[model samples]
Target: MTQTVSSTDPPTPSSTRPITRPTVVGAWHDRFEEILTPEALDFLARLDNAAAGRRADLLAARRARAHRIRHGEDLDFLPGTGSIRRDPSWQVAPPAPGLTRRRVEMTGPVTRRMTINALNSGADVWMADFEDATAPAWQTVIDGQLNLLDAIRDRIEFTDDSGREYRVVEASQRPTIVVRPRGWRLCEKHLTIDGRPMSASLVDFGLFFFHNARELIARGAGPYCYLPKLESHLEARLWNDVFVQAQALLGIPQGTIRATVLIETLPAAFEMDEILYELRDHSAGLNAGRWDYLFSRIKTFAQRGPEFVLPERAELTMTIPTMRAYTDLLVATCHRRGAHAIGGMAAFVPSKADPQAAERALTKMRADKDREAADGFDGSWAAHPALVPTCRDAFEAVLQGRPDQRDRQRDRQGDGVAVTATDLIGTPTTTPPWITLTGLRTNVSVSLRYLTAWVSGQGAVAIDSLMEDAATVEISRAQVWQWLHHRVRLAEGLVVTRDLVTELMDHEVELLHAQATDDRDHRHVDEARDVFVETALGEELPAFFTPYAYVRYLVDRPLQPAQRPTAEDLRRSEVVRGHEVRSEP
Candidate 1:
């Protein structure tokens, strides 16, 4: 087997191998020690023996709870969620998963043309979308969003510069059309179809996503979503719970929906598996959001450190290596768990909108397709209708020449697993496709343009300290620590960062084997000890404990509606007012 690389594309080495593995996130170390203290474990042992009889009821209750969850009879409904929050309520158990599992792919303006061309060109599980694809806008945001999706879902066609007309297959043939609404922060500005107001919170975003879910699903589309700008597991859990409630309200089957969370946020990086675990019942897997993730890293670390600001339109290679490493990690992490690691959105190529730029853009788009495929991405997104064919062809070509089936020798360890084939060096490797080279170019553009915004930690996480803001650091630490705990191997009978730690986490993580080790807890411990419930051991902590800031919001506030002008109110003013006053007929 060989590690494949495009002749022109470069490779990025990942430190996920070691060196950057933090012993602990600093804050968590104290808690880990406080709970697992010698005195606590002894107390538990004595209590366990004394309460052995009570264990039966505990086991019975646990089984009953699982049964309720599996049956969907216990769905917890919260209205604020279905409207703006986009969160799903997983209170009711999800039914058996669908046989035809699906993963939706997102495309940006750069690759939209090529991606659409490809969707029409072949059969894909779904062509995911981005409200994040364009510049932020509002005032009928719902209508505008629906229009974009509706247009894409129909028989859309595009023409390339060389007089090549690409008419993609109707969504009927492909059928799955997924549209991800704008996330919480930007959602305050969006309005509903009835021109209603929207809230600015995650719960509100959940409600918005939930309310619209029916419309998207009603038109021969199974409900699906791609989570973006996510901050923590709590955020995902919020979405899961909101979704459950939304379905119940809409009269849909309990678990008829599905989702894929974009692991673009740096803090979301280390906690990839945990986030998915929270949404495992409905998860499709994950994607490494290049532009946003890199942007986020810079915002957290560079802005304040540097005296001068970056250029308006800088070069794109600055973060390619990191992006590559991120994608590699995402793919490895997902595949390790038998899930698909969808590739990043392509940045450029096929500017059918401007004939003059089409040639240059097409070249870049195909290159990105090739690179993404080479990086082990199952598929990538296309922004334009014209780009679809190229993107689709590129994916088909990469997979066509590869193996049809994969072996489950180790039973793929975690959230996902990318199937690999032999490469020139006799090393087993998985890449998206050489076709995605253009994405590198796009990534560079997004990196340079947004680098400043990201470094300032201006996007989502706002708090920062000496190294990174407290929130960003916590999020990052969660992922890193969790991945390490599950994938890394401390020597025989060794403890996690035991060399650096005055503490040890004896959790079993053998189940999350793909995390770092090929077997029992390479990154940290066996899967059996994979998770840590703060509440389960809450009393054990040095005693002062807050569940998590985000968790606090989930428990206390239900998603709610925000302020917005009525149709009559807007019509009598501004754009409409001017047109009316002019009396143009």
Candidate 2:
């Protein structure tokens, strides 16, 4: 049954709240709040204006076109009041546990080849994503999600290693499929079909996500989606309400629809439990998205150019700490909720473009797989099928207990789960890892923290004896964990604590202490803030925000916006000089 939402979720009535709230949308809802830097303030202000301005412009254009096309005929422009779009958030929702069923993740490059390839990947689910990997083009956004769905369940075809195309009968049984719809701002203008812009409310996008999800459901899957970048629980709740409305319209069951959100933003992180709780009946649990989360952190505190400035993709992928935290947190959060906490992606997928680099990448995969298995991740994803064998082999090998086979279990409990204090450096265990884990509930979070803090700059202190800044604590601590005090069964949940970090690095306590303080220098923070301000005000912003805005800036024509505080020109805000925006009816 779908639960009722509580007041904690922060749902909005249509007239009272704007679609996006800057502070709420930007950060996690933590109890602690900090003053924003002037640059940060400027960036936040622009983000608000940029998202709203583009939305309003798109809305106004629709209204003018509606006036001409129908010659002022009455229209059902907005959905009826008290409909999902206008429901009281909490009143319509209630909390529940173990709301989501099984989950499957989908990811590939944003090429047409990849999109289709992802659809047939041997995963339990698929999400033809528009959020992270896709270049933000509106046509691509529409075409990608709104592809022509054949009525009959078409047999999926793929080329195998031998270059032979075979039909996928039972081989391609994906239980779920979804598309991350475009966000409600500049991207909306780009999805414009014909001469008119797609509305800010994304009436069309909503229909697309709804229609496609239903078709997938009709194909023996369920109505499911992994929603991304949800800044608040209410956002999750809001999506739930939308799903309810769509279901009602489509004649589907009210509670059959489901969503999972990535708690990437700071505010969302703080309010995570609440948000997840609000939509618990329909929520599929949360994901700890690292790159976007870090990017969001920068964006929340710094100026527009600097805040939005991200390190090269390579840096993000290689950041062991970030990846570890994300994977650990996801596993913990999901297991606590009885939902599966899937691990992070394998960033080092080998590319034929660089053979030497590809070989090195394979070596890293071997190391990463060892760590991931050691950390107790149930499953992980890869960008390529070539990496599939590697992933499968790693998961298989860990269960089989290849390396670190020494030491009998030390301390063990909680439903027969065993965790040893003595390290298993090099003893070949006769027992199967799964056999050892029978009836066991392992917390991946607990198992991972001891390792992650080492990589994350948590314990990168100066070495007194080595007399260099290069190394510190985590190395020795990890050696003991990897080779010795083999923590096998009882997996730690993904809740961060200073004790966990310090205790995990117990043997190298002093060295780890020094390494943890290494990031006291804020040079990168300074560089990020400076770059943001410079780029945001540059000529490229109009184009960057929306292709329509870019085109308009060149042609120099006025466009009417549907809502307030719009038009960067303050003078125009006081008058109705620009063209008006509205509906298609």
Candidate 3:
């Protein structure tokens, strides 16, 4: 199903057509066609036509703000939104029906098998992620939506290549389904309205809400969402407005859609109170998205000097002054506004092959959960199903008989947990003793491995027993860039240089090639090197590597009219795209 499009002719626009007559741009699959009907495409078109302009404006604003920061403009809280934060009387909407007891939550990509497993993973909530946790292949995106639709109907099941069967439990035993759509920055190139790509966020949300909002509501749940990578309160406001219009379009109640914002970016941290205030009607809570928060910090202040250059991802613990301020402020803000405060992901995937390692991972997870619980977090995220009980036990100890600790508002006025602008920036004035060669190698290895899997339509990869996502790769490559930019000194007093990084990357690439099981793996290893070097050593850092890589590698071509694409075709496109494109390291 490799669609060969004429570069001379792109998808055509249908702006003058009726709402029911929008055109879908990519090749269609029969399975996906079941969920991506004309009605669904029309709904997405309506959403795009309505809010796409605002989305573009906001993105432009982001670029302008980044330019200001690059020119030494300081970042601080918004004076314009002061009254909303100062008004002590306002609160977010009450928790939606099934989201009230989220002591432990599981998140993963929405493959058919993963979907069934996550729903039965014994957690209070299952966040079916189409964002960082998923590779944005055309088939992967639509298949995910179909999986969720089938799961909602209790007809979803999977049989692996080894013939192992997977199925969901009875409705009474399933976790609450909450979808995390693609961020606002991404566009669904496979689908378009008026020849313009629609926001991936709206496409994911539109199809899911259009189909499942009524079904979820009928079953005592609502169309709950987790908004990711929002950098400002205004972004949250855009999502709130989308939620409002989505509910109304489907004839559902205004407050039926609930969303939790991931305060993962540096700017979003400063505006946590305002973000909640904007979406108060449909807000669920704010999550301490630790990895992305760290990545955001580095990206924001990468040029600010060695003060902001992080040593290693593992060294930046949650207990650091900056991280503590973030969590403390998040808990306080959510509780102040009657929203649940969710903690960050415990991404330690347990290994049965090594009992001692599993125990160590569990112990670290226990400590992390205990800290969040003590800090008054209502719930937290687990990347693996095995760690769910451990997380539950940690929170259970603190929760006692209560569903959540939203009642335990650690307010600055009363609890003495004060967080300032300086604390949020969390820059260390002093330099570390040394950066290690092992850290550099680890970054290269992990980034390469993760990028390989990502190019193959897998987003969440378990490497060295840690669940790694796009944020993990972002931090990995960004650190290399930051280290090179600062000429960071190693433990042996040698300054890290671009040549040194290239040498190490070449060695790692050779090592991976030796371990390659086939030509396909070898090519991925090669492309991984290309993507890493391009992103890490470029004159200007690309905002996100996924989108650039996706357009260049994941898509084969435009679909022929009435032609059906297959999963195999999508997989082949990755290899085809890899072979056709080459970049210098």
Candidate 4:
């Protein structure tokens, strides 16, 4: 049902006229009240009012495009936007303060301790992620905003249960804060303007910009962001419009806001030049959001055939042809436009309990960073603060006193690097190696572990010496679906049928139940099992698991009655606006 705000609603009273209050539809906690102040809600409403319709249109367009692809449509760079791509005279706005030296950036959830730790982690930039790294619970959303606010003011601090203290370090020692808001597909149901839910993207960006944009400017930094899950240049255009309007509304300069987009989706990969062109005025650069990109590839090409069926997630390294093409194109495109081409995440988490494992993990991380640096990427992401120095040293080896290699154009004539649409597609000609039992078990374990924490409002968790986030969960579940659909054979020559998958899922659930140490853990494990089964084994693939799991498990709401709607109820329902009414004799 679609709910529209009525035009006849009462206007803001004179006392609250300057900053109109919004109707918050969900429960309000103590700290939530601080973040959702009258002015902040009003600001969010303004953003929603301006961009909500266009967001809806673009989301509909996304569905249409996907539908066309399913009907055998091919994807290539848009000829419509060719002029924007071919224009050689244009460049994005220069890197904003603190963004110039993003040689090693750290990413994590915006929890209090994480905010402090990431800022003090000695990386060049800290991406305070509210998207994939966050679960989007109401309290989490509000608290993340509060944490960022406190971090900005240098008042954030925390102490562990073991009595270890944490506090923001001296301003000079801290990493520059770059906030990543939720994507366009999510809506903040807790807050509604005019009966319709506001975009979560707008809400996160709105609250943060309202509270901190001016302060950041005063601190010699501007409101910087990492845009995620964009699938087209239209989406980038929407964000650029939002930035321009936001700066105008907040009295900041037009170009004060800078954004680095995550070219994560398959479609966005084709529109690299256009994506940068759309946001050129506010563009910082682009990052190779590797995991999600792979997930997107599987999702987009799932039904195409065996050629698109990916190998085990562990086996598909960045050096693979498809990945190399994408990264090469990204670096080439960014350098051509004078933008930084940041690399993918090194998600290895060192273990304190095992020296050998820690050494191996560090070695792997160093190698990954070395490849990214050698490939002409300006910087890369580290999932843990401990990996920062390894990333820094790797980049430092090639950078040699340079902040970035934006001047190193990879696509110049005689550069010996050539990337084309065909290269980007890079469909495998041979079948992938058989799925190993260990690989299958790893998928089940990691997905279950990650989903358990996710349902409990922890979006980022360290599992088996690796940091797992939503992207990891996506990859795991998508692999399960692809394997099942393809009836993939294991090394033992046993096929992955429904029965086998169900048996393994049940075994994993039992293992988790056995390991549960508390009621909370037990409940979360149960929910995780359900989430995994439904998302991985449903008749049709779900576009995303988070939205369904979010409403079912995360939102703090009362259960609805199970009664069917009556004729009178339907007649009077505001949600039935678009339906035709008829009287029966």
Candidate 5:
């Protein structure tokens, strides 16, 4: 059942030396050979050999820092990097082509349909998210690369089960593409190097950069990227080095790869200036990754005290004092250094079933985008195409034909944005008794349904009109753990305990079954429940639920050749690229 794809390697100069090829442990899908070519695999192997050790060291440093924080070490700005912050003369590199006017960027997974829809959404930039918005099934990983390649060449198309067609707009009309690879902590278990799993970050970035860097440059856009889950400036330094080596090895000009780091972690927020300094030569800007920021806040200080107990996820918004402080500091820091300060995702998806509810959601979304535009943010993100115009209009009102507002020096003009370390970490700003029965139920319902869909290969699920991704799910589960750890009692006089959570989860599962129209919905509910109990109800709070759940549930064996089909594999058949095939027969 072992299948290997063969294709000619890209022509290498005679001066180049051979590289050890990384083993492809995943199954081969149709036309996957186009992307997993010999030269491409070699490129990934070389990049891994160069930076994998540094990546591992930084991840270990992250764990050590988290351990220290939980054991009573206070989190604050680094005293060592004060010189980088105080020095006013440094600035990030100017924006590359297709990145300067990112006023209404659309964010979605790189699925074929979603990819075409996002590029044609009329947004200034389309972030093809391979992290939160994508469930990293092996087929999904390879298929996404193929879709990107086809889209860039203007040959991508989609026909649904009913034969309805989907096509991308002309190349001139499409939004600029920016890829968000997997974070440093995750591993591409299917791709091994020296008998160890390759860093998923490098696997994703290396594959895309090797195949598309030249084509994208010829199209007037370079290999732009968005780095996620960065915990420190050192992580940024590692990525910068990777970019440098990537461009040099490929013979593309240095500084052609521009990256926007997501300042989602609490430690990253403190080291913003130093991070920009580290990647300043190839920096696009920083994003106010609000959802993961909240998750980080809870995870970092959950064991310390009851003071860090967070309210419900819905109750924590951009208006909260701490969140406001985070955004203000981000905008100020980015604007101070002449980088585009992009805002966070607007997760509302216009409800097709209810017009009134849709109107309300749009109104809320508009207000959020308007506030961000007023706060000196150059642009923001929308989860759906319908929400793009709202985001665009809000920024347009302030931009008035200007590409960005990076010229506004919000850091120098006001004390309102003068955020301190205490302002960033001081939580429960509102009154106590924040946890409500509705909040607890909402968390349970979201956890069950989202995880169900996630295990079934859908990373971005629409739950109660919001586009729920890994970041939002992380926030939900983290809140549950924080509440349980603090013994939080709702206003209804019900204490959050293992028994109560189990009861609620059972009830939610019943409701999900009743609402299920087919077996697809029921197929993964039990697995999702197992994941929820393990991650949310455990004694120790796990930093993320994805790594554990992914390894346990989503990893599958490679597909057999098309001609060989066993009865077991036939029972587990799936529709891949319009063909009904047994994945592991």
Candidate 6:
């Protein structure tokens, strides 16, 4: 039964109006009211009221599934959904406008500067991400909405402290904007409905859709999205339902929303066909979210045994058998259903100062994109603007003036890649002595550094020349837990113990302190260390590190207002030319 909201069908005041107005627990920021209008708050409240129960049920199902996997249950393609996979005639709706030829997609947080940079990055799509790339402070969320609105209206611009301006080009040259909302597992503590924190996923999607769906459609691009961290087909179905209700409430066409689901979690990998089927009417395709997929693998089977233990992070390349099977199956499943198959991110942040380092990074990025192209991926992701050309060139070489290769069905090739359950879960031997002393230290250092930055309201940072986000941090900490839990022996003959991990963490913190530029940076180190210790050395593996850290550091104890940007500060940063960015700053 579909519950549609219309003028005739009034919402229950108790459910729709939780209080006199939507209670904003977060500090008021400049221009937040522009995005969080009374009408918008009501819409979010209604959406949450309708979807909360189902979200809770599905999350419970996830916990149940995790418990079963923890005990003995193995993952396989659902026997019940075999018919859906067997049915070859079904296909997702044709690509929506501006989404047909996505040769390269640039992803970043939705700050004012990033919004300008990504639109001008020359990628076919700009994934303005609110998930891994964003720290999700209250102001950040509101400002992100404002930035997207401004970008859509061609009113966004930014200038650095050096007086260098960044502005969006004319709409003709700009990439299509695709927003990636946060996942289901987190909540927005700032906004509460019925005396509880609202679902972060709904808050993000609702605010964006409510504010931009119709405007984007009028601009010849519908509300495009990249769905992340979905663990099952059921979760996809929940999103489909939300889209239906949202479109109906807004009086938009039913199938206007097109989404590309990131097949990042292990369970989602097994149900790719089902996930696509669930959102078939609105499906764009699936992406190889390699980092979170690795994290999911560790989280799912960490205690199962040594066979499931993976090698160090560096050794877990896309070419590994398990990883190869994942991508091959993704390409096969997507193409078979007439959907595009996108590739993972080339996370290298190329440096021009050191030509050798830049060349090495570009060389690696080119190889990665080239491999994805050959494997039938329609497009790939670039974290930085410099790598966009590399990604596009790779797809162009294979596509050869073509838009996408959905016609290239890898499943029908010679010997027809028939991936099985073992191919995905069964660990492969990749030059043993898995846990090196250096590997442990690197994980500790990287996780601590990233967490410190994250607590300071930076979600994505370039660490060791790679763009490290929450997904990468999850992998880092989760790997440490797995190694410590199993008491894995390092290549240097030191077994992973709590004492050893503590010593290494202290050493890493001291190293960070030595690198700190100010007292604020030093304070963040202690906070970040607390976060690292809680998540990495816990008795039981926490599903995610962000929720707890976010509440403790961001929500409950907010950053000083001075540290956040003001609207006036942003206004003074840039001077926009008429429908074009100034060539000179």
TM-score per candidate: 0.46, 0.50, 0.91, 0.91, 0.91, 0.91
lDDT of 1 by residue, 46-85 (tens): 3222222222222233234334433432222222222221
Instruction: For model 1, give the RMSD to the true fold.
Output: 23.6
For all candidates, the clash counts are 142, 39, 0, 1, 0, 0
Candidate 1 ranges with C-alpha deviation above 4 Å: 1-130, 134-137, 145-171, 189-197, 200-221, 304-320, 351-361, 401-585
lDDT of prediction 6: 0.84
Error of 3 at 159 (Å): 1.0
Please report how far candidate 4 places residue 152 from its true position, in Å. Answer: 0.7
TM-score of 5: 0.91
lDDT of 6 by residue, 513-585 (tens): 9999999999999989988888899888878888767766776464223343332222221211111221211
Give the alpha-carbon lDDT of every model.
0.39, 0.38, 0.82, 0.82, 0.83, 0.84
Q: Of models 4 and 6, which has the larger lDDT?
A: 6
Q: After superposition, how far is residue 72 of candidate 4 from its true place, in Å?
A: 1.6
lDDT of 4 by residue, 544-572 (tens): 77766776677665421134323232112
Cα misplacement distance, residue 79 of candidate 3 (Å): 1.1
Estimate the overall C-alpha local distance difference test score of candidate 4. 0.82
Candidate 1: TM-score?
0.46
Residue 449 of model 2: what lDDT? Answer: 27
